[model samples]
Target: EFNEVFFDGAVAAEVVGGEGDGWSVAMGLLALERGVSTLVQQIGFAAELERVVGAYVAAGSGDPVLRERLVRQWAELRTMRWNALRTLGTTGDPGAPSVAKLLWGGWHRRLGELAVEVRGAAATAGPGHWAHGTPYELGLDEEQRLFLFTRADTIYGGSDEIQRNIIAERVLGLPKESR
Candidate 1:
């Protein structure tokens, strides 16, 4: 039933030429979850990585400008997977910060890359263009709604800026700057 609905919806969007946006991202996440689960069950961790990387590439291919952004998104997910594995490997016991450091470091670097992508896209596409609809013509209520919802991506795993700070301080050993 779920697969039926999912496919039907995707077909409808294709027929209508829907402006790929949040809905596409949601579908990608769902596919990633399912792929990861199947790979974990059948082939284990290494296979799971392969599955995720493939999924990431496919997702990124959706938009040329968004490709690098999606790659960074994939990297963030991979880092999360690494952190989860490390925690499990430690048997829930604390040890050297090396594992956490590596995870955070990777996350930070990816966040920086994503930031650049976002800024570049924004410069070319302009604000509110990242989602849907034109920036100048959004109605008041629509504008407010989009403003709130568009933030969902940045906040979801972690804000890109926060991730950047982690990379700079812990990974790069740079002095902290006040926000």
Candidate 2:
């Protein structure tokens, strides 16, 4: 694969990126599920984060309190990703993948919010209100319910279109694209 050749074939996990369907921690989840190592390096800002800290400390530009706050946020986000990896490799409620999905699922429904969160940039939304609902309310049959509860095979939490959009935009990072 191009990525393997580009990275010298050391990649054990791949963080899929796009403007939608961006299950941010999915690669880690995949790594865990496939028994691959997630610490193979260069997973997006993962490699950059420490350098960012170093640069900030060296430059000494930002306020100490502000830096501390940003660090805390980064810690929270990192922990969330870690939890996802942990869940996929575990069993039942002990896995706690649903908790991660519950939190991340909301982001898929609100791309504008994610744009703001990730890039501090404003983004517009289509004409639909998004809110989490139970599978029963969504008219999901047993199969869908089983899929939803298990967090298996996918990392989305809505209609097929919404799910596909999340897969397209976030996971694939395709901007303003269709199908």
Candidate 3:
């Protein structure tokens, strides 16, 4: 049986900034324990994952195998997450309001794509990805939690570039740019 765990801001912060394998594993387990119904609540969790990856990259740990695995895992997870958000978008149930529907329709897609980009960047940057110091310094648990968490932001709903184009064309009604 699965239970839902509501993450307060502090817990969220801890999850995002945790460190090492132990913290990473614990965060994953916590997420899993929350079951599939909590996808909406878990958006922050996904963002945390992105931050964690940034931290790992910054730490100067030259583990190519680990990095590769992280990239693959993140991609797969992001796809699943995007699908979930997209599913939420199509449903107009009162429980799923229009604002959330609209947000999922585009914003979430962009985030998913961003996750993919970060993953690729992490791989390309390798150990040097975060060599210049990370934007924030989360604890080890939060760091690990975030690293593995953000894998799905890029590929599932839409990519960052795609989302930007969408906003330009649809919301702003700007003319399409030529490739």
Candidate 4:
């Protein structure tokens, strides 16, 4: 199940960004990934936010708490967009990527939460009743799926703790956490 590459020679000509410059190249790519990719994700987030807003409106639940949370989510999305743009334009900020990651991860996870919460108790129910077929055969609806899938958004690329550590040590020039 494993294979390996054999570079019989120096392969200097095949190196990217010249020889011994891999770190800078890697960081550049990471910057694009964290900054540009976040902008792309924001488009989808906008749609998701709209959907949540739609659900909230349709349900007509005059819950001030949910309304406040929804408005805050919208505002945060805008803030994240501007932050990502700032990170994209800046250089020499090693923690920029981490900040973007943290911003979107938690924002998206909360969006998922809001998606289901807007739908209320029905969010927990599958698309089909158990009497129609086995429960596993009945898949989740959009809100349900959103709620489940976004649970990992904060965990996959990096956890909140890791992002905070990157900000603390790299961006703020604080002392490193003891391992």
Q: Candidate 1 on 1-179: residue-level lDDT in tens? A: 01223354455456433655655565344334333442243233234334434544644545555565556555655665655554443322222133343444344344444433433333234343433565555433322333334445344343556556655776678899876
User: Using TM-score as the measure, which candidate wins?
Assistant: 4
What tens digits encode model 4's per-residue C-alpha lDDT throughout 52-83? 99999999998899999999999999999999
Tens digit per residue, CA lDDT, model 3, 32-51: 43234436544664665566
Clash-forming residue pairs, model 1: none
Better of 2 and 3 by lDDT: 3
- Write down the TM-score of every candidate: 0.26, 0.31, 0.30, 0.82
For 59-113, candidate 2 gives per-residue lDDT tens digits of: 5556665476457645755765676566545543322433444444432233222
Instruction: Name model 3 segments beyond 4 Å from true.
Output: 1-39, 89-179
Runs in model 4 with CA error above 4 Å? 1-13, 17-24, 128-138
After superposition, candidate 1 runs with Cα above 4 Å error: 1-69, 89-96, 121-179
* Ranking, lDDT, top scorer first: 4, 3, 1, 2
- Sequence-dependent TM-score of model 4: 0.82
Give lDDT: candidate 2, residue 27: 39
